[model samples]
Target: MATVESVKTKDKKREKYIVTTMKRLFKNKLAIVGLVIVILQIILALFAPFMTAHDPAAQNLANRELPVFSDGHWLGTDNYGRDVWSRIVFGARISLVVGITAVSLGLIGGTILGLLAGYYRKLDAIIMRFVDLLFSFPGILLAMLIIAILGTSLVNVAIAISIWSIPTCARIVRGSVLSIKEKEYIMAMRSMGASDLRIMIRHILPNASAPIIVFATMRMATAILSTAALSYLGLGAQPPTPEWGAMISQGQDFMWSAPHLTIVPGIAIMLTVFAFNVLGDGLRDALDPNMDLQE
Candidate 1:
């Protein structure tokens, strides 16, 4: 039986561990602020319909190109006389959808390839060589090539972004799997007659989740940026649809006359990308508690 003092000491140790983790996170002020901004953006996106008074795509030529503080339009109107603020709120949905879907596709494909390559030395050369070949090209350039072939559609944009993202995800997961597969627990599982698939799925993948999560977080920001680029190039969501990239494309023509049209969407993209990057950094630190200690 444990003594009261022993129990108290154990509780104190647990408390100290939690405090240390929180302290490390709190030290990252940018990360904290980024998290707040991300939350606000998500809230705005989720409740866009309720938050805005006008339909995002509704056109009123009479109200076209109103200034930021205009009577009916707060953030102003665009070339088509649509409310900029309304369009932006609705556009958040497109950005989030493309980012999340593209990342998910990349993560799934990369993880499978990485697991196979890392677990079987025979497969490593073929798999890693292909990944290397992809890495040789600039990511944005590769995405452009894909988009050029696939034509301009939202699904095509997600596919284009996913293709470029796969190599990075594969590399990270392969490294993690190589390290994890050699551990004692994996060896024990193998000795117990676990099949390669079972071990890879259950033991190896679970242990490698930390780095995968970090990669996913960072990849989200990359996906958003890539989607925007695709849209800018006229290879993404078409006009009359409220996408951030499309908004910017339309606003560029009126930049001098109605700077708010361009500035608001630009701010949206900058804040979103910055938020995801900071959040990713914070997650990396949080997930790997021993990283600071080792440093």
Candidate 2:
């Protein structure tokens, strides 16, 4: 009877928390805009096939550079004469796949490392030292080095992005764990004979999750941008793939004659990064109930 009642009360608290969070998040206009933008992009990516009958790779040199919003092409054709709108719709699929997958890899791996380091003094020194070594190189440089070794491909791009991202996530999660493990609940779990792994996983991590969630959201933007940059540099998704960065790279040569190619993809990248950043900020504010929303 006591356990049943306790579970019911806990469920109620969770329900209330969800409702409050939604209310706070919706109150932020910028966040709402970001959410809408992201949702539309996701929808477009999901329905790319149905949204456009033209193949993203189908080229018609005779119709090249027809200009934006032209017949059928809508946003115009690229130097390759491929449909810009179709490529963009298709591009979103790969861009998001790479970004989300890489971030997930980093977050999962980093969170585990951080939990171990924060809970164990001996491990903390070694883990942090490795992180410090990775930090010596710039994030993009580190990603480039990894890509250089692994060679270029969609899968490799995701892996390269994860390499640098892991260190950042580790550092952030480590800090959170360091603070959370010292709290009373963690101590209580320890006193109750819970194993170190159990205590850290069940108690410390839940308390530390908010910051990790926020960091993950922001890191996603970085990952997407990095993927695009790498693609632009010819170290990411190969030619004919229509990845936004690669599209921009292809269009760079025709900048003077036809600016639409670069401008379209450029705007896509910008809006994506902007959406994630604003959404991340909104999450931070929404998660912290004490923050004054009026201002």
Candidate 3:
């Protein structure tokens, strides 16, 4: 009976381990709420053509500066009598595109540099010096400088944001690689005469991926904000494009008469950034078991 009881206890322990390992993520109330908001934003972006009744770019000076909850234009019209809600909906595409593309560029560039630097001590000094140079400038300032040189356009804005983000991603990846390269498994692989490429890709990268994943998630939010800032400054997606930043810029003149233009996009930016941040936090906690226990 004691033997049977012991066997059952071991089974329970195994079940517990499996359950914890496969626990549902983003289940926290805040995280779930954030996810819902993000999903709505994505849906709005994807279905803007079908969902919105008005052309986002169509302008009517006669009906300009209408107040919210008035006429056929719900959420009011902007300075040009363009639908504020429709513009906000369409703007999601530009924001998401910039965020995802810029972050991807940064991730690819930074990961390569970080892997190289961490794997080869001889290259570390050179890579670290360049990273230090980038770090000297604040990220937004660095992006602005790049934009100044590249000139204002959607592609230029993306490039500028990616450049600023690369150093941060590289630094995080380097730190992770530093720790991972010293692990017993890495040393074992090295001892087996694995090629450098094989060792870095097969052994080192997998172990170092957690921090990189978190950084990428956070960077997406930063990219969105940066893109918006560029647009506000007339350096990003141009007028008639329905970008959030440009929308806010156009709405500033009618701040008193039609506040929806500013308020709506402002809310959009805030909610999007907040969602990404909360999701990132949740992901960080979920991925790191130690973090869960610490809380």
lDDT of each: 0.88, 0.89, 0.84
Could you give candidate 1's per-residue lDDT for residues 1-295 as a string of tens digits?
5778878997897688668766776778988887898788888889999989999999999888999978878899998899988998888888988999999999999999999999999999999999999999999899888888988799989998888888888889899899999999799888989999999997899778878988998888889988887788788989898998888998899989998888998889998999999988987897685866775
- TM-score order, best first, reads 2, 1, 3
Backbone collisions counted per model: 0, 0, 0
**TM-score, model 1 to reference:** 0.90
* Most accurate candidate by TM-score: 2
How accurate locally is residue 44 in candidate 3, as Cα lDDT from 0 to 100? 84
- Backbone clashes in model 1, listed as residue pairs: none
Mind giving the per-residue lDDT tens digits that candidate 3 earns over 15-43?
Answer: 77546633645456676776787788888
Error of 1 at 65 (Å): 0.6
Distance from true location, Cα of 293 in model 1, Å: 2.0
Q: Which stretches of candidate 3 lie over 4 Å from their true place?
A: 1-24, 292-295
- What are the RMSDs of all candidates, in order? 4.0, 1.7, 5.2
